[model samples]
Target chain A: AQSVTQLDSQVPVFEEAPVELRCNYSSSVSVYLFWYVQYPNQGLQLLLKYLSGSTLVESINGFEAEFNKSQTSFHLRKPSVHISDTAEYFCAVTRGGADGLTFGKGTHLIIQP
Target chain B: NAGVTQTPKFRILKIGQSMTLQCTQDMNHNYMYWYRQDPGMGLKLIYYSVGAGITDKGEVPNGYNVSRSTTEDFPLRLELAAPSQTSVYFCASSYLESTGELFFGEGSRLTVL
Candidate 1:
């Protein structure tokens, strides 16, 4: 079985400030990691993913997550965040097979200007 | 594209009542999943279907049942409602199980009293 843990329950940052949301996972087999973002009243959307290859995967919206195998972490980071980036972020992991992902409790990003 | 569609955006049910949440995807995805989101919990996988006629349990599948009789439809059934069952349900589909992005529905909010 796979499990995900998000260390922060809520993070408040000023607009245009950098932020990092920590995520760690535990799995017996190889895993695929993903970051999903959910806006106020919308469903979750994929922000980025790490399957294989470069440990650093980036989303088009300037969000990036680095997969650290030794640390079992896939922390999401953004150099500069906007007010619109306020949302709930989730970290998920799967064993790279026909299985559903295990998700973290989520980190609520609150941007203040 | 309509993408993944989930019916009854909001529903209220009393304890011991039974109801079915309908889900459908028009993207011809072979993998479909049902997840529930609580207040602080990100999301928990309740059930998943690899394809038509093939369904499996996910991380949290105790109080829910699911059926996938066709390639486009996967309905989640709650035999008897409980207060714990009150949550936002999301239906998602993907072309690949672990390596692809998951397209999600708007979500179905269910309240049980």
Candidate 2:
């Protein structure tokens, strides 16, 4: 079985400040990691994913995440956050060939302006 | 293109009432899924379909039913709504399996009293 965990329930950061939302996963087999963003009253949008090759992946809006094998972590980071970035972020994982995903509770990224 | 579309942006129901949440995707994705998001929690899978005429339960599917009659339409049915079923419902589709990078619809917010 695979499980994901997001340590922080909420992360408040000032505008233009860097922030990090930590995610960890436990699985017996190979896995793929993903970070999704949900704006207010909206569906989820794919922020970034870690399939293979690069341990570090980035999104278009300056969001990035690094996958650590030894620590079983895939923490998301943003160099400069904006007020618009205030949203709920989710960390999810799936096995290489599984038909479903296991999601973390989520991290509410509150960008203080 | 409308990646995914869910009907009835909002709905209110009483105990034991029944309703259907409509979902459609223009991407011709073979895989479709339904998920529910409660307050302060990540999404939990409700139902999934690999293709037309095939459906299966997800993490949480006690109060929900679904059918995949065609590639574009995957509707979720609530047999007997309960207060616990009050939440935001999401429809998602993916071109392939083994990845969590699915395209999601806006969502359907349901409030049961």
Candidate 3:
């Protein structure tokens, strides 16, 4: 069985400040990692994914997540956040088959002006 | 493209009531999935289908039933609604089972009273 853990349930950061949302996973086999974002009253959208290429993956919206196999972690990071960046972020993992993604509890990123 | 569309954006059900949530995808993807999102919790997979008529249970499938009669349609049925089932449900589709990105619908909010 695979499971994901997000250390922070809520992260409050000032606008224009850097932020990191921590995520860790436990899986017996190799896995693909992903970060998803959900805004208020909306479905989740993929932020970035690490399939089999480089350990670091970036999203078009300036968010990036690094897959660290040794640490069993994939943490999402943003150099600077904006008011529009306020949303809930989730970390997910899936093995190399037809299995569905296992998601963490999620971290609410609240940007303060 | 509409990508994925879920009907009844918002619904309210009473105890012991039954209803079905309809989902369709315009992209003609072979893989479709159903997930539920609870407050402070990330999405949990309810059921998934590989193709028309090939459906399987996912992480959370206790109170739900699903049918995939066509490549584009996958509807989830709730036998008896309960307060625990009150959450936002999302329908998603992907081209591949493992590595492809998932396109999700706006989501259907269900409130059971």
* Number of the predicted model whose lDDT against the real structure is largest: 1
Q: Kindly list the per-residue Cα lDDT of model 1 for residues B5-98, writing each as its tens digit.
A: 9999999999999999999999999999999999888888899999999999987899899999999999999989999999999999988644
Off by over 4 Å in 3: B97-100
Count clashing residue pairs per candidate.
0, 0, 0
TM-scores of all models? 0.97, 0.96, 0.97
Query: What are the chain A TM-scores for all the models, listed individually?
Result: 0.98, 0.97, 0.97
TM-score of candidate 1 versus the correct structure, residues matched by position? 0.97
Please provide, for model 3 over B1-113, each residue's C-alpha lDDT reduced to its tens digit, 9 standing for 90 to 100. Answer: 87899999999999999999999999988899999998877889999999998999998999999999999999999998999999999999888744737888999999999
Candidate 1 lDDT for residue A91: 95
Q: What would the per-residue lDDT of candidate 3 be over residues A13-109, giving only the tens digit for each residue? A: 9999999999999999888899988898888888999998789889998999899989999999999999999999999888845576888999999
lDDT of model 2 at residue B41?
Answer: 78
- Candidate 2, A35-108: lDDT as tens digits: 99999888998999999998999998899999999999999998899999999999999874426667899999
Model 1 CA deviation exceeding 4 Å by range: B97-100
Give Cα distance to truth, residue A6, candidate 2, Å: 0.7
DockQ of each candidate relative to the true complex: 0.74, 0.69, 0.69
Clashes of 2: 0
